[model samples]
Target: MHRFANPTRFLRLAAAVLPFSAAVAALCLGAGLVWGLFFAPPDYQQGDTVRIMFIHVPSAMMAMGVYAGMAISSAIALIWRHAIADLIAKASAPIGATFTFICLLTGSLWGKPMWGTWWVWDARLTSMLIMLFIYLGYMALWQAFDDQTKAARAAAILALVGAINLPVIKFSVEWWNTLHQPASLITMEGPKIHESLLWPLLLMIVGFGAYYLTVLIFRVRAEIHQRRTRMLRMAQADRHNAMQAAD
Candidate 1:
């Protein structure tokens, strides 16, 4: 934690990990999509329409996972003042939001075929929508402040507060009757999905996680460089002002 706080050390670690993450993401996504789309058996009831689950399920899972990660990073930044943690949280928001958007879009697409409607106010669907709003709000909060430090603090608090929605999203199906299906992959008894479908879904989930890591490294690295550039310009301005005062 503290050891990796330094930008240089973090950058070195990211460089080492980036190639592996990228490779795994590419391999898993390619294999999973091919297996899920072409090889796996379709749902007996839904037929080809079931194929959308490969993308929708993984993106939905990743949306929550990424937000959980952001909240954890925000907590670290607030508690330990880990310099890299705030940047990680900032970098994760857009990616999480994109995943959330994909989940909602695909869910709507899948729903129209299965449920005879493109939209619903079901517990799971509504909570997932709220999660998307929270992600957007978190990103907006960061931009609300001119001072990065203040922005980070405000965003961190919002992230921590927004975390309450996560459980709601997760358990919404159980808490109420909903058109959405209950948990299949993570049931207490075990995954209810058959092996052929399950394997490809698992692969997609892993790929999504790896992809998030790959992109996070790039975004965080860019953020570090941008912050450094901003600091340098500010210092130069201060020095010029000092020189003027001396003259």
Candidate 2:
């Protein structure tokens, strides 16, 4: 991990991995969407509406997954003062937030037909909403200061603090009398879903993960270049001012 602290080395690594991640993302998402939507049999109960799970479930999982990643990166940044880790956490904020929003949106859409309402204050839904707020707050903290060092530190702390919500979000349905269903894909007994439904869902989840990786690499690389440009400009300004003073 420390070896990747060097931006150039990390960028080279990212360049090599980018193509593979992008390809996986495109292929899996294409295959998964088509298979789940057009080919998979409808649920005995929900009928056509079950198709939404392909989009909703994966987005929901990625929303939490991305936050988990941010929390880990934030911990690394705080503990080791890893610059690349900080940039990674920073780059991930918007993407995580986007995923959270999609989860909420799709959940609502799915809920309307199944639950007979477009929204609910159930434990899972409420906690997921809180997750979205936490994501937004995390992003806002990064922009709250001019000194990026302070901003990074502040944001890292918030990220670490907000991580407590993750478990609550995950267990909310089990802990409370919620409208949400219990775990089907991941449980002590393994997936309860049928193979036909499960396979495409798994593919979608993989695609989403790959998509996140592909985007994170691009964002982190852009951040590295931008930071380097800023440093070069500041150095030039400092040298010019020193020369003028000497004159």
Off by over 4 Å in 1: 1-5, 168-191
In the order shown, the candidates' Cα RMSDs to the true structure are: 4.2, 4.2
Give the per-residue lDDT digits (tens) of candidate 2, residues 122-226.
555566788888999999889999988899999999999889766765586447643445433221123256788999999999999999999999999999888
Q: Provide TM-scores for the models.
A: 0.89, 0.89
* Candidate 1: residue 166 Cα off by (Å): 3.4
Which 10 successive residues of model 1 have the least lDDT summed? 182-191
Any idea what lDDT model 1 has?
A: 0.85
Q: How many residue pairs clash in each candidate?
A: 0, 0
Task: Please give the CA lDDT of all the candidate structures.
Answer: 0.85, 0.84
| Candidate 1 pairs with clashing backbones | none
Name the 10 consecutive residues with the lowest summed lDDT in model 2. 182-191
Candidate 1 Cα RMSD after full superposition onto the native fold (Å)? 4.2
